[model samples]
Target: MNWHGLKAIYLHEMDRMRRTLFQSLVSPFISTSLYFVVFGSAIGSRITEIEGISYGSFIVPGMIMLTVLTQSISNASFGIFFPKFTNTVYELLAAPLSTFEIILGFVGAAATKSLIIGTVIILTAGIFVDLHIEHPFIMMFFLVLTCVTFSLFGFLIGIWADNFEKLQVIPILVITPLVFLGGSFYSINMLPEFWQKISLLNPVLYLVSGFRWSFYEIADVSILTSLITILFFLSACVLTIIYAFSKGYKIKN
Candidate 1:
């Protein structure tokens, strides 16, 4: 299917990432590094370990997932949003690329960028703490799955947004807060029993739990549940995108 058109769009998005190296790459890296420094120093001093893993090491998976999720959304959203903002989306729409091919290019490029940033952060984390992967293949699986799922979600955001403010709204107001409360820096087990049950309502918990499980073989929830949760969201995003494309939501208007 329209492989050439797909490659063109993919390369265009990837090239923009190269051009915006600082904002796209360095900014997130520095911000996540700060989380490690602050949390590892101030909080690590008080709490030595969670579930037999060192405080500094324990947060690595969560921190990486946090960065991946935000970066995926931001990268994919901006990748497509800029085309719409510049009135270039119509040109792409008029091209030979089908909806699936267009999505493949944009979302694939965005996921690639997020995966790169996540890998960098993981390497950066290793310098500060001793790290281990109980299951390296599983770790990679969860990493790729998270990037792809959230990239699709971000693509939806791109199509739905009408302005710059709308682009920032969900990530700022909703996602970041969910991550903080979703067992990123601390285990949900530390919470009161009632609150622990309450924490389950936050979807990000499953993400962090599953990713963390790949690392230490310990988790707040079962790996199966986490896998299912991400898969469910991924499928939902896929269906929503197809419907939006068919109905020409935001894109055609």
Candidate 2:
């Protein structure tokens, strides 16, 4: 593998992040903090506890996941899409870097950003409520898994998009809604039995449920199911990426 080339690409992406510190970092940080302020105060006043966990504390994982998911997609999609927009991707395609190196560089940087933001979200949550982790390692696992998987998904979207408008479409129109409806603020069980059954079909529920389980040992679905759901999405993203690169879907042309 071309380690130098990979590092160059990775550092370049990270440098871009450093340059756009507020948009890349501060924007989400403030947005999440506001969610805590609004949801933690307004809603928490009404629903003091959800399944024996403080309403504020219970929503922490979901809120973090919400930001992580959108940020992962936003960072990665823009990372690749800018190159395509500037006609620089042709230069990259002609370079000595392998497809794996290219993916690792972009996806790795995106995941790293998500990790930083996720950690920040956790720290921010502490100010609003007393927080404890029932399973720290499991939380990290779910966190890392979600970051990597979604980054890859975003990388895929970047490749598929031909315009800036297209880039924002899926994240705003599709992903954000899924995260909101995925039992992020409340338990699926709180839904009526009929609606609860329907909620089970939303894939993101497994992610929120699994991450929440690591925090409070309270989950709407089994941990095993959550693990499987994330792994499945990870595999799907990996395979789709492979296909895109092999076919030179948007990179070459």
Candidate 3:
């Protein structure tokens, strides 16, 4: 691995984000706040607490997860997509860095942005509603894990997409619907037997449930199971990317 090349790419991506810090940072924080207001206050008031936690508090992790997932995907996807679109990727391909190094540089930067945005969103949630952490370590662990996994998934999307419109199709059309239906606002227990079975198939549910467990010391699914699911997804994404790079799919062509 060429450490210098990795550093160069990492620094370049970080600087690009810094240049648009306002849109990249402030906008996500504001948008998360609106979710708390509209869903946390308005809709939350109508729904009773789940598993003894208040409705507003119950959705905090899901809200935070939502922002982390979307931002990470957008950041990583754009990081690679723009370079490919403008033909700058040829330079990267010719660089001394290995494929792993290239993935780390861009994905790491994307995860960092999501991590910062997620932390800010958590703090912002506190202003509107009192927050508590039943397991601080677990909360931080899952936060970082969620960021890394989604960033890699974003990297995959960037490689697969050939245009700007195609780039957004995954996050907007696929991820968004999966998130909303993934028991973000309500517990799976609240659903009928048929729907509850179906909800289990949505991977986002495990993430939200795991994150919520960190906050309330409780979850709809077991924390161990959630952890395993996250690991499985992360491993799968890494393998897919490795195969893509080895085959020169999208990147070489």
Candidate 4:
């Protein structure tokens, strides 16, 4: 492995976003604060606590996970898609870097962005509400793992998207809706029996539940189960990306 090449690519992507650091770092916090104001304060006041945690604190994990997931996906997707769109992917293809190196570079950058944004959201949430962290170590573990997993998923999306518009289809059409309906603002128990069962089918629920477990010491779903699901999804995504790279899907053409 060309460690230098991987580091260089990672740094290059980091620098690109760093140049727009104000927007990259601040925009998410601003948007999340708005959610707190609108959803947490306004609507949350009407709704009682979920699992003994105030509605505001209850949604913090989901908000943080939402930012992490979306940022990781966007960063990874754009990192690959922009190169392909501008024909700069040819440069990488000609370079001595292996596919693993490329994935490491892009995915690492994406994960870094997700981590920063997630941290920002957490800190901002602290400003608005008092939150208790039950297991800090577990929270950090899941945060990093989730970022890396979704970043890889985004990298796959980048490879599959032939056009700029197509690149956003999944995040816009699929992910956004799943996040909201995934019980981010409310608990699954609040739903009727049928809808509660249906909500279980949404993978984001596990992510939110696991994250919430770290903070509140309570989870809508089992933390062990969520971790297992995350591992399975992460492994599957990594294998798929590797297969795509080997086949030269979209990247070669």
**Top-TM-score structure, candidate number:** 4
Q: Which ten residues in a row have the lowest lDDT in candidate 4?
A: 244-253
Tens digits of per-residue lDDT for model 3, 47-142: 868899888888889888888999899899999999999989999999888999999999999999899999998888888878999999999999
Query: How well is each residue in 76-121 modelled by candidate 1, as lDDT tens digits?
Result: 9998899899998988999988899999999999999999998888
Residue-wise lDDT of candidate 4 within 89-198, one digit each (tens)? 99899999999999999999999989989999989999999978899999999999999999999999999998989889999999989899887888999899999999
Candidate 2 vs candidate 4: the TM-score winner is: 4
Q: Tens digit of lDDT per residue, candidate 2, span 134-245? A: 9999999999999999999999999999999999999999999999999999999899999899889899999999999999999999999999999999999999999899
lDDT of each: 0.93, 0.92, 0.91, 0.92
Residue 140 in candidate 1, Cα distance off native in Å: 0.8
Q: What is the lDDT of candidate 2?
A: 0.92
* TM-score of each prediction: 0.98, 0.98, 0.98, 0.98
Number of the candidate with higher lDDT, 1 or 4: 1
- How do the candidates rank by lDDT, highest first? 1, 2, 4, 3
Model 4 Cα shift for residue 22 (angstroms): 0.9
